[model samples]
Target: MRVVSLVPSLTEAVALTRPEVLVGATDWCTHPAGLDVARVGGSKYPDLARVLALRPDLVLLNEEENRRADADALLAAGVPVRVTFPRTVPEALTELADLAGALGATAEPDWLVAARRAWAALPEPGALRRAVVPVWRRPWVVLGSRTFAGDVLRRLGVANLYAEDAERYPRPDLAELRARRPELVVLPDEPYRFTADDGPESFPGVPCALVSGRHLTWYGPSLAEAPALLAAQLAQPG
Candidate 1:
């Protein structure tokens, strides 16, 4: 089956499992480097005409990574679209398993199996440390409540300072964020690249954990090593 994926993580999963099935993907789908598929623009605003032109049997998307208007447009054009939203590691694994089934896998793929084992092997945290996770700057947006990234950090023993906030992603002023007095600031390099030089300077007193956005946000094969990799980063001294 020909597939066009707008979600980067899903694109990686599908590409690694069944590369021939992917005929198109968003330019942001950077995994499996040297992927030679039609670029469908960005995940948020893909080129619908180019996507449609691919004549894919299935268009894969994530509710968080893609816009509803694009999904609706595809549906209106009589194209089949599979939308997924996995808010936690287990949910993400389940989504991948389901996708594997859709891809005609008789059993869970190696990466999926390893991911399940890796996450399951993580020991429960003794105490949860309070942290403020910034995904974007300028306007300053953070992981609030019910986010996949927040759940990932929770599993790693870090509690988001704004996890109780109503908004999934909240725009809080720098002063307000600083007033929270978090134990640490977890910075992932995506949506906005938070480098050691770029992000750590903002929080003078707080230690910052610069992490890989792919591990923190994406829900595909990265799940296998994310727990260990993120743990190492979170363990770094101030």
Candidate 2:
């Protein structure tokens, strides 16, 4: 089955699981190294014409990463679209398992099995560290309630300060962010590249953990190593 993936995580999952089935993917699908599929632009603003030209039997998207208008347009053009929205690690595994079933896999993919096992092995946290997770700067958008990233942090014993906010991605001013008094600032290197010099300076007294966005945010094969990898980064002295 020919597939076009607009979500990077789903693209990696599909590409790694069944590479030949993916005929097109967004430019942001940067995993598995040297993926040579047709680029359909970015996730939020994919080139619909290019996507249509691919003539894929199926198209993969995420409720958060993709626009509804794009999915509608694809459906309007008689293209089948599979949109996934996984808010927690278990949900992510379920989503991948569902996708695996769609790909005609009689058994769970090895990566999926490994991911399940890896996450299951994460030891319960002794104490939680309150943190502010900024996904973007300028306007300062942060991880809020009901986000996959927020849940990922929760699993790692880092509670998001804005997780109770109404918006999934809340745009709060810098002063307000600092006022929250997060014990740590968890910075991921995607959506915005928060380097050691870039993000840590903002939270003067607080420890800052520079992490891989793919491991922290993406819900694919990377899930297998996320627990240990993120733990090590979070363990750093900032």
Candidate 3:
């Protein structure tokens, strides 16, 4: 079956599992290095015409990454669209299994199996360290409650300072974040591209760790390596 994926992580998952099935993907889907699929557009603003032109049997979308308008348009055009919302590691695993099933593919890929095992083997966070994780820098948007990234960090013994906030992604003032007096600040390099030089200096007294956004945010094969990778980054002297 031909598939078009708007979510980068899901694009990678489908491409790596069965490349032939993916006929089109968003411009942001940059994994599997040499993917030769038709580029639709960005996750937020997908080119509906281009996507439909691919004549895909299924279009994949993420509830967080994709816009509702695009999904509605596709549905109106008689295009089948599958939207997934996985806010935790287990949820991600289940989503992958379900997606694979929909594509007539095996869910027991090596990476999928390893990811499940890795997350399952993790010990509970005994004493959590309070941390403020920034996903964007300019407006200062942070990972808030009920987010996949927050759940990931919580599993690694780091509690998000704004996890109890009302908004899932809150744009708090720098002064407010500092007032929280978090033990560490976790920075991811996507949606904002926070670097060691750019992000760390903002928090003078607080320690900071620059992490891969893919591992921290993406829910795909990356999960296999994320647990250990994030742990190592969080352990760094920052």
Candidate 4:
């Protein structure tokens, strides 16, 4: 069946499923490398006209990266769209499994079993850590509660200082970080490009680590790598 993936993660899944079947994709769907498809556009503003011309049987989407009006337009045109939004890595694996099952695809990744086993072996943080998984530098968007980063950190025993805050990605003053004093700050490499060194300069003595944006923040095929990646981060000798 011909498929069009507007979301980067779902587009990656289509590539994982069968490259030949992916008739259309966005520019950022570059996971497998050499994913050759007409670059319709980015996730936020897909080339709706180009996508409609693809004559696809199914269009893949993600609630996080897609706009409500755009999806409504596709639905109005009588195209079947499947949406997936994973809060954690395991959920992403499940979504992949479900997508594969629906598409009659073979060779499902062993993420479901491995992810749980790896997560179970993870040690917990007994107290709060003043880490900021911020997405941007100027405006400062953080990895707040209800997101994959927050959930994974919570499971591993670390807590977000802004967990009690109202906004998910609130802009906080430097005083907040100083007040909470995170043991080891974690920053995502993408969106904000915040590195471990950036942490030391901003919040001195707070041993920090630049986290893989996809593993911690992305909720797609990348989820399969979360448990082990997180474990390695946690296992680092202080």
Worst 10 residues of 4 by lDDT: 109-118
Q: What are the C-alpha RMSDs, in order, of all predicted structures?
A: 0.9, 1.0, 0.9, 2.7
TM-score of each model, in listed order = 0.98, 0.97, 0.98, 0.85
Give the runs in model 4 whose Cα sits over 4 Å from its true position: 110-117, 120-130, 196-199, 234-238
* Whole-model lDDT per candidate: 0.92, 0.91, 0.91, 0.72
Candidate 4 residue lDDT tens string, 63-115:
87888888899999999999887776467667878887777766674544455
TM-score of 2: 0.97
Clash pairs (backbone) in predicted model 3: none
lDDT of 1 at 54: 92
Task: Work out how many backbone clashes candidate 2 has.
Answer: 0
* Model 1 Cα lDDT, one tens digit per residue, 1-238: 8999999999999998888899999988899889999998999999999999999889999898899999999999999999999988889999999999998878888999999999999999889999999999998999999999999999999999999999999999999989999999999999899998898898998889889899999999889889999999899935
lDDT for model 1 comes to 0.92
Full candidate order by lDDT, most accurate first: 1, 3, 2, 4
Q: What is the alpha-carbon RMSD of candidate 3 to the true structure?
A: 0.9
What TM value does model 4 have? 0.85
lDDT string, candidate 3, 52-160, tens digits: 9999899999898999999999999999999999988889999998887888875467778899999999998899999999999778999998999999999999999
Best by lDDT: 1
The Cα error of candidate 1 at residue 47, in Å, is 1.3
